[model samples]
Target: MRKHCCTPGQTTRTPSGTKRPSVTGSFPADPILPEMVSLAGGEFLMGSAEPHAYPLDGEGPVRTESVPPYAVAATTVTVAQFDLFVTATGYLTDAERFGDSLVFEAALPHDARAHPRVAETPWWAIVGGADWRHPAGPDAEVDAVRDLADHPVVHVSRTDAEAFCRWSGTALPSEAQWEFASRGGLSQQPYPWGYERDPGGEARMNIWRGEFPGAVSTPTGKTFTAPARSYPPNGFGLFNTTGNVWEWTTGVFDQRRRDHRAVIRGGSHLCHESYCRRYRTSARSGTTPDSSSGHIGFRVITAK
Candidate 1:
């Protein structure tokens, strides 16, 4: 096995060449995912410094990785871009079509109380109106959500993300590629910048500031999604890669690793030390490709 993260049906080509991106369209549709820039892959370090060392369930064995060169998205996908894909492709996201999707209930407004969230984190709720277009639930308006043009799109299943990428002549990043790019030249830091963490003590990414499932209110009004570029980029010129939303990748998890779900990278801003500690450098998680939830979104990549 060559540390496979790829599945069949999608095309793959090395990103080492010098082919520029073709003109896609105008302002209304800014090349699908404007937050990302394709990176030329080579090789990099993978895995944690110790086995089962991470507080989360997925991290493990410190191992050296030598992934072949490839390109990856610079940031997670955004709503505006996904909306354009829906318009053009007539694609229905899993959440929208499923009639309901999982949400971190406590993350909702307190006045908008509904039911106790799910058990895993006590924040997930099966909200009927939560979808990519309406991230806050049905009757929610995207127009009122200002400056989120660059924020990562939410409630999109892996299928939804893949469809958009395919329509745009792109594809999801592989597990190896995603990690390599996310490292952004930093060798062994939790964040792309280095182990020191957000300079001046600012929240490095958009993860929950106060608490996990039980709490949502934060000093920055951090209950919900923030702008895509709300934080600065990592050492590799990538932004919002760590904490905004979990990003989908093209790799399969179980075969290469022992995880049960499909692989996703760049822990979301929803990450918390007490709850989901996946914000670290070596963390990894999984879900069915067709399963769509509010916490998941994705970016894109193309061959050079």
Candidate 2:
């Protein structure tokens, strides 16, 4: 079975192979920044040894990793936030440049589903015009940004995220920094909140309910990304850290592999217990630096 976090869609090996218009003007001096949570930073147990964890993804061995003080955005960057960065920089995301990206099959219109799908995971369709602006391809409404303003921006590549970080005077959190913050002070727990997937029988994060890839519906009636702040924060006051979208981090997936696949933390709304048990803090996956998909997004951080 394919690991849930292993959705790279069609990745262009070399980022330089897909360049677009150069960014205009200079970085905005006052780009809007997302709400950031300051972590006092300390040693925390990292990785998992649970039977359900994907050992091949390097999600185990349970070691202690320490991070210095840093501040992470409480939520993943939203559509509105990404729009502001693009508007300020005249930047084009790799998806926009490629003229297509991966879209979840369930989110596509019936006709769009006919598009070529990733052979490894048929759930992802290679969708034209599926950039952050047109999450559902050209079918997305003109006000898509406003409609998804509060939702985590999807279909953004790590390079796109780095551009946003550069413009916003921030940086993508390292895997250690992200895990420390997502753990929310919890020590080696399966989730940010605690051991229970849903403590008190309540959903603490936005993830696939029922089943995955084909459920087509959820208990909340949302088959797509939720508002960035839809759920309650963890103990450290981070929102949607485990689900909603996979967040890009600064670290590489593996040192041994020559592939420049960067690490992506958390899972997304597509995750389910039946498969893709990656909504936990320690869980991780990786994709090409230039790959973009509807379920991939990122947050930024600042060193203290």
Clashes found in each candidate (C-alpha, N, C closer than 3 A): 10, 0
True-vs-predicted CA distance for residue 240, candidate 1, Å: 1.2
Name the candidate that leads on TM-score: 2
* lDDT tens digits, residue span 1-304, model 2: 5564445635543334655555433334444548878889989989999877788889879999999999999889989888887876678888877788887777776655678877778877887777888888887452448677888898888888888887677899999999999988989888988898998899888788875666675444433888888888889888989888899999888899888678999998888888788888899988888888878889889889
TM-score of 1: 0.80
Tell me each candidate's TM-score: 0.80, 0.92
How would you encode candidate 1's per-residue C-alpha lDDT over 116-233 as one tens digit per residue?
Answer: 4444344565566677766656644443135355667877778777677767777787776777778888786777777755668876777666644445653335336666667777
The best candidate by lDDT is 2
69 Cα displacement, candidate 2 (Å) = 0.7
The TM-score, computed over Cα atoms with residue i paired to residue i, of candidate 2 is 0.92
Displacement of residue 161 (Cα, Å) in model 1 is: 0.8
- RMSD of each predicted structure: 8.6, 2.5
**208, model 2: CA deviation in Å?**
1.1
